[model samples]
Target: MLTRTEGIVLRTQKYGEADLIVTYLTSDRGIIKAFAKSPRKTKSRFGSSMEPLTHSKISLWGKEQASLPKITQSDIINSFHQVRDDFHDFISVSKLVEMLMALSPENIPNKRLFTFFLNILHTVKASEQGSKDVLHLITQIRLLATIGYAPRLKGCGRCGGKGLNFYPASGTILCSKCAGTPVGEGKSFVRIHDNTVRFYTHSIEWPIHISNRLKPQQVILSELSTLLDKHLTYLLSKKLQSSEFLAGVRG
Candidate 1:
């Protein structure tokens, strides 16, 4: 069977000396891995279309349930070279991609998630370098919300009580009353400012294209970023590999 779909190269692995295994987020197939024979050679049909972050139109040959399909053709639709070229931008987007792959199930068709990610790539590419820090942060928050992994910071996770502390283990805020409960007791919490909560709420409610309209203070960005990192670490059982690199770069 031959399958045709548009995809963004999430990552690629060397299958042997010459062959490659490419993982992609597809328009119709969510996440899928396809085998590209000898794309590493001096002369190969895939060219640079298999490069990570490249969005391409691809044709795969295999059965519907095949774990790995063979790529027959891949034509570049958008190389997204700019995103991969900038160290800061690439690292920021890479963190999101890591989180996405960790959370999104493979071979599950999610057109909305696919389109949202493509939009993020375009937004990051077009955004000015100076403002990318905030843009990238907002993108992370938005992506989490889009995928239902966003941490709830507005109010208590159990009840609607007001709270300023976020428990990474619970992935939400917990008022003092709620925190006194057995499950919440002894859990560490990050004391957050109301501004961080307001900014987070806005990031989720506002449309992605207009997310730039929001201008948060540096402190708020840092606060929210740290909270998210903790939340993700708890969810994934480890920090995203790119995050430490990003922190070092920013430092």
Candidate 2:
């Protein structure tokens, strides 16, 4: 059987010598891995369509329950090379990709998530260099919220009381009373600034296109970024490789 779908290349891993294992977030299928034959050769039909973050219309040949379908054809809708080419933007966006891959399950149909990710790619490509930092940070916050992984900052997750310390293990702010409770006892927390909470709230509440208008101070960006890293680290059980690279670059 043959299947047709629109997909954005999330990542590609080399298989054998010339073949490749391409993982994509698709319009019809949430996240799928397709095997491509010899796309690495000098004169392959795929061209650059298999590159990471490329949006392509793809044809897969396989059975209904095939674990790994074979990709027979792929035509590029957008290469997104501009985002891939820039070192800073690419690394930042890579963190989002890593998060998506980690948090989202495979072979589930999620059209809304697919559209959200595609819009993110376009937003990153068109955004000005000066605003990319805030844009990327906003994107991260939005992505987490969309997928229900966003950390709670506005109030305590359990009691909705006021709190300044964000507990990564709980993935939310915990009030002093709540923190002293048995369930929250002994867990460490990061003290977040009020400005960071305000910026995060707006990031999720406001629309993405107008996100560039939000000019947060560098300290706010750093604070939120670190908080998110801790949240994801606890959830994923390890730190993301791209995040470490980003830290090294910024440091």
Candidate 3:
């Protein structure tokens, strides 16, 4: 059977001499892989629509349980050309796609994750200079929330106190009393600043809504990145290469 859906291109790789295997994070199907014939050759129908970060309407045909679907047609909706023109923005967008591909599973339907990715792409392409980092941070927060690993920021996850500090390993906030205890068997506690706590609170509670209005300082971005890195590693059960590169760049 043939089906049409809106999807965001997550990644692509050479499949054969002239074909490409493209992975998409679709609105209806969480993560899907489809084969595009002759995408590498000139005058191919797939064209640039198979590129990472491309948003398009796609037609696919296959059995529901098939690992790879056959792509019948694809129409580009947004290519995010501006991101391609800027090196930093391009890298940022690529990392976002890589993160999605790493975290998402095949055949499951997750509308929130789909919209989260699309919104990040749009924001990265539309923002003026110097907004890439801010946009990236916001997207990471949203992605965490979409994947059900979002941290608690309102009160301590350990003690439920109003005054809170984040423990990345647990993906939750901890109060002063809770902070004194070791979060893990061997790991020591790291003290979090009040401002850092507030920033994370906002990131979790308000997301893009509040993050868009407030510009976080470099220190805050660094701290948040560390926290997110720990959480992602815990959830994925491994470290992300793109995240490692991103951290190096930020450092």
lDDT, each prediction: 0.90, 0.90, 0.75
Residue 170 accuracy (lDDT) in model 2: 85
Q: Model 2, range 1-251, lDDT digits (tens) per residue? A: 99999999999999998999999999998999999998998664495899899999999999966879999999999989999999988998899999999888899999999999999999999989899889888988999999899999989988999998998988999999888887635488889899999999999998898988898998999999899888888877644565567789999
TM-score, model 2 to reference: 0.92
Stretches of candidate 1 exceeding 4 Å from the true structure: 43-45, 183-186, 238-251
TM-score of each: 0.92, 0.92, 0.82
Give the Å shift of residue 39 in candidate 3: 1.0
Worst 10 residues of 2 by lDDT: 237-246
Task: Count the clashes in each prediction.
Answer: 0, 0, 0
Model 3 clashes, total count: 0
lDDT of model 2 at position 107: 95
Which pairs of residues clash in candidate 2, taking residues 3 or more apart in a chain or in different chains? none
Instruction: Compare the candidates by lDDT and give the number of the best one.
Output: 2
* Residue clash pairs of candidate 3: none
- In the range 120-213, model 1's lDDT, one tens digit per residue, is 9999999986778889999999889989999999899998899999999788999988888876354888999999999999988888778888
Ranking by lDDT: 2, 1, 3
